[model samples]
Target: MLWTTTETNETLAAQLSDELRVSAVMGQLLAQRDLPTVEAAEEFLRPRLAQLDNPFALKNLRAAVTRIEQAIEGKESVVVFGDYDVDGVTSTVQLVSMLRTLGLEPRFCVPLRLDEGYGLSHDAIDRIFDGDVPELFIALDCGTNAHEPIAYLRELGCDVIVVDHHQTKTEAPKGCIFVNPHVNDPEDAPWRDLCTAGLVFKLLHGLLKSRREAEDPRVEGIQLKDYLDLVAMGTIADLVPLHRENRILSWFGLRHLRANGRIGVRALAEVSGIDASQEMASSDISFKLAPRINASGRLADATLPINLLLSDDLEQCKGIAQELDAMNRERQGIERGIAAEAERRAADEFADEPGIVLFGEDWHPGVVGIVASRVSRRFHKPCVILGADGDETHGSGRSVATVNLVEVFQRCTDLLGHWGGHPMAAGVSLPTANVKAFTARYLESLKALYPAGLPEPSLRLSTWLEVEDLEEGLLDELDRLHPFGQGNAEPSFGVRGVVLEEAPHAFGEGNFRFRMPAVNGSRTGVAGIAWRMHGVPEVGQPIDIAVRFSWNYWRNSRYPQVTLIDWKPSGEN
Candidate 1:
């Protein structure tokens, strides 16, 4: 793989370091992120709640608040329909909880992934509404382009409010208070990329502010901060860029998550083996918490996690957490079998193709997205993994950094039934008989887009650091840039002239553990681990290595750990 380094502005870095009293490395990182002025860097480092823009600034938010107020005043029958993912579950819980506090016990439901498919579907609406139609219908995390379902609700004499973040396809739904920033707000708005949970948080903030202005006693003690845990989960899980208001929400949200104030989260964390007493990082949410929450949606009804989050009972939450964990384990086993098969198929069939399109007759539809992601990364090409869903093949597509799945899908729209998502990831469904045509069209489109062939895979180093610079001070400085995600990625440094203390200890499959010689006259060496390495580097020989530095919390103690990404003989770039 090719290794590249970001161009650094030394003058700006030095100026930031001097003015902000931060280490030179921190300043360099700030400059790399385009934080031009000291104020911008300072705000990025210390994101304050005061920095969040007014929720009322979002278009249609006031109308949504007014409609919700009418529901509260009349004690109208309310129903909140959400998707079957982390963002959707958390958004549903947050809005329903807040509405309950304001004197309305809202009925909440999430679409069953296997039965009703995704978003605001007529089948899902029918199942949720059954015989009783809600007076006020609120759709979270979906319904941006769900004109038919939104119209169906209107026909039932229901007022609709859709708080979504998905990009609109064709046109926006009519006759509803739609609050999607990507559609109605400015491109540079700080909250433009907020997920459904964050949007719901903003909605609640608006409702609370208006209620307080009206001297309502019920919302007096509603602490919005208490809901940040959910916001952080949704924001990080949904993979939105962590900048501006998103950074502020997630930065504080991780702290609130670590506090474990909510009984359900505390219980879920316990089952997930997360120590709530320590600093909660984005990886904890991405790898641990998010997967368990998503597992219920994939294998069963997503309402279980919503119920878990909203429940106040400790033992009940524990039972639900355990059930979700079991489902996740089941999901992992199913995913492993399918991924191994899909990888083999991609390598054998589409190794020379610009993209991969694989379909399995018996593959589980819910787990194909994860398999698509793994296959795409392993092959370094765009991939679409599909499973038999009735008469149609339905699944998801994952793209490499340089590819746009949405643009690619648009070229094949004639063969697709329904498809929509962001540039990097998307869901698609097409008739099973058309799968071959779609595959050919997908590959042809990719070739047309990139006539010179796809770009080679590469790893980018944030900046170079010396062995002496890998000290506690650097780690402390890195701490200020917590909760890294889509936009603000965790930095990986290129370190030169490193000699291992001893021969590395080989461990699990293609994995080994090594230690770097002591720096700054320290007694012990810095511990490091490398995964899936090609071969061990020579010991006692100076070499260049790319690594990510972080604290490894084990047995209730924290120690600096180095995660080796790549290494080569010194001077061999």
Candidate 2:
């Protein structure tokens, strides 16, 4: 893999360091984000809830609040519909929990991935309704382009409000309250990139403020901060940019998550082996917690996790958490099988193509997305993995940084059934007979978009550092930039001339663990681990290494840990 170092402005970095009283590395990272003023740097370093924009400023939020207020006053039946994902599950839980506090028992449901597919679909609607239509319907994390479903709800005398953050494929749905930032708000708005969970938090905030002003007794004791744990779970799991409002919410949310105040999340943490006693990081949500929450949705009814989050009973939550955990393990087994087969097919058939489109008659639709992500990263190409869903092939597309899956899908819309998502990830459905034609069209569209072919993949090091600089102090400074994902990425540094004190301990499947010499004459060396490496660097020889530094917590101890991204002989480009 190629290694590239990020360029930094020395004068600006120094100025930021002086003004913010941060380490030079912190200053350089902040400067690289193009923060124009000291205030901006300060705000980034310490995100405060007070800095969040007024929730009412969001488009259609006031209207949404008004309709919800009417529902509460009229004592009307209401339903909360969400997609079968972590963002959707958390959004549903937050909204439903808030509504319960406001003296309403709203019924909530999520579409089964296999039975009803994604978004607000007719099948899911029929299943949720079941001859009992609510007076109000609110869709979360989905329903941006669900015109037919929204219209159906309208026909049933149900008022609709869509709190979604997905990119709009067409004009907004008519005759409903739509609260999508990408559609109605300015591009530069801080809240523009907020996921549905963040948006729901804003909506609930607006509702709480309005109710408190009206002297509602029930909502007086309700603290919005109590919901940040769910918001963080959704915001981080949704893979939205952790900037602006997202940063503020996740920053505090991770803390709330560590507190483990909620019985449901506490139970989940216990099952997922998360050390709630330690500081919770975004990885806990992304890898450990989110996958468990998503596993139920992937393999079974997502309502299981929804119930898990909403249940106040500890034993009940434990049962659900264990069920979800078992489902996640089952999901992992299924995903591994599909990913192996998909990777082999991509290498065998589409080795020379600019992108990969593979379909398997036996692939589980629930795990195709995970397989697509793995295959795409391994080959460094845009990949679409499809599975048979009756006569139609339904699956997901995972793209590289350079390719926009949405645009490529738009070119092949004539052969598609239903498709819409972000640039890097998307979902699609087409007839089984059209797989060959769709594959050809997909590749053609990619080639047309990039005639010169995609750029070679490379590991980008945020900065170069001396081996001696790898210490707890630098790691402490890096903590200011916690909960890294999407836009606010964790920084990787290049350390040149690092001689290992001893041979790396080889482990599972081409993996190894090594130790760096103690910094500043400390007795203990920094621990490092590398996975699936082709070869190990020689001990007692200077080598260049790219790594991300962080605290590795185990049992009850915390120590500096280095995750090696890549390594080469000293001075090798």
Candidate 3:
């Protein structure tokens, strides 16, 4: 059963004329989704980018900038070590671009998702040390909890600066310079949901500011706004909150995306077919750019996406973007196949278990997090998915709404080799032999917290309405809820007593579509489709639906597509 909140029109929604303006259906949609308050409704209706906070406000930012400035002055070899995901890749690009403009050859290294897992590894550090190692290592999007690796680097007489946003363990890593937002007292920082790139952007901004203070004209022509494109992509793709600082970044980032975007980004936009002229919403990047960029690490090598982003050649970028697009298609197929197998295996392994833990001998580590996330959503339980190699296993954890994955891992610390992450997601390394024990102990820990079954997730619909209130202006207002992600979600509303105009139409083989009418004089035709939604609801059935309004710009024409949330028969059947 779905848990739902009451719907009441906020004053803003109530302002619309009952007859000529937005219909009751539209008002209810707004209220149900909690977009009724003037401020919230304004945020949902219009996101202005001018309000983002300056990056200089972060603590220890001055110290980080001082160290980088010193390194640049002394011509010290600098290495930027970022993660393998979109956040890591973008952080690498953002920093490297800035450092290069200063005539310093800033070398970069990203660990292989399959080989090095996530974050700084002793193996990666060893490789860097064996080669022309940098005197200073700047770790972005990761390395806050890399106690062992950071210690090893310090032993080698290297200075390490961590600019990450992940939640840290109770005992922080020692010896390396840590600039995590989670550090110190919780009351100080205004926001905690900063993704990795956002942190790096601030550090870079501070460095530039320090240079300007020194009367260095070298900072000129370095457009920080140009880099917001990367920041916005990483922040949204990382699923951080899109309020306050994040909202400001993404708001302007969309403008940069529409104008003066890098060749690679432009190429990506081309194939994705997101018109630069139109207002690109957060949904556009989540469904389009993120998957394409992530497919590199998922199927083959992450270097492809990184190289594509760093490339200046339009033809080369276009080729690579198209290649990544194809690779993403292939990844979708692989994910589907592996997910089905993993589900079957989970069903057998977790028959009576309170939590889920599963591993495959040759499972692709690159895809384990994706699999784990899928399982967690599917089972409504905390899940840990592992990929084995000889005696050691590398894995990623994704928790449900009620679970604290980092704390769970902290309790099982004795069995883990290297571990770190946030409340919702974590990564760990354990002996293959310890997997069963860890799973059992973790399950027991969960029992202590939640003795009963997990509660049904509440779908916080923004508003409620009837079928007759659809209009173009209301759809326009929906664009304001952008950068919709982890903290602030896209508005979803429900409509009741909607009569299906025909049997849900089946297209794209199994993709389902539906048609319905409007209350206006004109017969307002609409179709809603769910992938593989064919043969679900019978034709002419009266059903209640939860939906988000969207504009699908296809073939030079724009029309509404209601992203189906949930639909059930309206009457007691």
Counting clashing residue pairs in each candidate, in order, gives 0, 0, 9
- Please write out the lDDT profile of model 3 over residues 217-307, one tens digit for every residue: 8888787788988988998888877766677777778767767469999898778768766666677788899889888876677778888
Q: What is the lDDT of residue 80 in candidate 1?
A: 96
Better of 1 and 2 by TM-score: 2
Looking at model 1, the pairs that clash are: none
RMSD vs true structure, all candidates: 1.4, 1.2, 3.1
lDDT of 1 by residue, 87-118 (tens): 99999999999999998999999987777667
Candidate 3 Cα errors over 4 Å, as ranges: 6-50, 185-188, 273-279, 507-510, 532-535
lDDT tens per residue, model 2, 29-122: 9888778778898888888999999999999999999999999999899999988899999999999998888788999999888877778888
Model 2 lDDT on a 0 to 1 scale: 0.91
CA RMSD (A), model 3: 3.1
- Model 3: lowest-lDDT 10 consecutive positions: 16-25
**Poorest lDDT segment (10 consecutive residues) of candidate 2:** 516-525
Clashes of 1: 0
